[model samples]
Target chain A: MSRIHHLPLHVEFGDCDPAGIVWFPNFFRWFDAGSRRFFVACGVPTWKELEKTTGIIGTPLVDTQARFVRPASYGDEIVVETSIPEWRTKSFVMKHRILRGEELLCECNEVRVFAQRTGADPHAIRAVPIPEDIRALCG
Target chain B: MSRIHHLPLHVEFGDCDPAGIVWFPNFFRWFDAGSRRFFVACGVPTWKELEKTTGIIGTPLVDTQARFVRPASYGDEIVVETSIPEWRTKSFVMKHRILRGEELLCECNEVRVFAQRTGADPHAIRAVPIPEDIRALCG
Candidate 1:
């Protein structure tokens, strides 16, 4: 099992929609934050530093599935638990669960790849092989 | 087959990440706007109006899957095409495709429910049966 990283957050009023609940897209934002925090917890360098040293930009999401189990409102305290349960040659699966106390509010599984800029264009990026050293550090 | 609605959008600078690519979560936000536009195109009243008469607040996503195909950036003009492929007793499937000119950028399928406030608490919501009239309008 990989290490699980927990990121605590406080829901702000702006995070809620007119329905007085957190907008669905904001959950994705939190998940992305949790992913980066997980890498930091694993002792991986920031994507900017990695780009300079390894020519690797960052992990970019290719596919994702999310399930919303409960509604969350502004002023609520939440925590995101993130882990990588599987890793492949160029892609990895990141799982994130958002909880309010003991209750699960949402969960997501994202497939992302380590990408490197292929050309001068910023959008020109391609998935690169997972760096073995980084993988070891994460493990 | 349901009526397909298209919503045009212009990508803004703030929508991009440090990588100069559209942040993935913004795609979900556009998909949601496309969903509401789809209903309006079908001649269904806005959720707020519906709530006044039918107690239906809106369609809230329960499950969603998204696949990112190509990267897009600021200044790009995109369109979101939305349609409903299936409807169930208390939930329906909404499909959204994002395209930049002829190239597809991202696609998503979301399972959503018609909800009604169960109590004074905003978080207290429960799925309700699919409204026959609204379904007919969308079809």
Candidate 2:
């Protein structure tokens, strides 16, 4: 089986546009939520905990690319599969695919960077190296 | 003045996440709205009008790449700038920048293809040539 994690999502009315279909943009929110869940499952603390514990900051998206293949309507039961395909010194890449049963809805790839939040500015935060403890649990 | 078109946007509560900042995904919706307005200003009919007239469809996105530079909060009045950089027979490209005054919020480049819908299956839609009028106006 793939190392992918599955996240089941329900489309809310608010997720729809005037066209009565799930607005294309909402997939990104769902993708973000799924990533959070995956990180927690991998034994990393929640974003809040990470911020408090390591003084490390939340990962901000540096780049994102998506392709829409199908339209999803309101109330559709969708599945989001997420995985980390690449991890580097200062950033990591996540890939997501949204599907309705057998139908593919959209696919996205996102690159996120870690930064240290100073008083008023953010400084570049490097990976240094994944500590054995964290890497064992996370990777 | 720069050829940049400034479109003021309202940040709806639904646009925010639990962190109380606008989620990154909603920026695409705002970008689409700004692009629609730009097309209207260019004397190109709105997407709905084109759909009605030539059976020409709203080109579904094939790819989008975006970077989030800053966080925006709910109720913030932000401006989005959109410009068409390439107009082709089968696809067109646009670049967008979202800003809050002088602070840059996000930047995105999107590539979309003119597609023809087939039956009720959105995925079955096939990319076709850009309608003559649209090509002429955009060219």
Best by lDDT: 1
lDDT of candidate 2 over B53-120, digit per residue (tens):
65545666777888877777777889998887876678878889998889888999888777665656
Instruction: Score candidate 2 by TM-score against the native.
Output: 0.81
List candidate 1 stretches off by more than 4 Å: none
For model 2, the superposed segments whose C-alpha errors exceed 4 Å read: A12-14, A18-20, A120-134, B1-3, B10-20, B74-77, B120-124
Q: Which candidate tops DockQ?
A: 1
Q: Residue-wise lDDT of candidate 1 within B1-139, one digit each (tens)?
A: 6788999999999999888889899999999999999999889998889989988888889999999998988999999999999999999999999999999999999999999998888899999999999999988
| Candidate 1 per-residue lDDT over residues A4-75, each given as its tens digit | 999999999999887788999999999999999999999999998999998898899999999999999998
Q: Which residue pairs show collisions in model 2?
A: none
**Residue A60 in candidate 1 has what lDDT?**
90
Error of 2 at B61 (Å): 1.0
Q: Against the unseen true structure, what C-alpha lDDT does each candidate score?
A: 0.94, 0.73
Give the per-residue lDDT digits (tens) of candidate 2, residues A10-125.
88888875444676778888888877777777887765777677755556677888887777777789999998888776677888999999989899999876544454422223
The collision pairs in model 1 are none
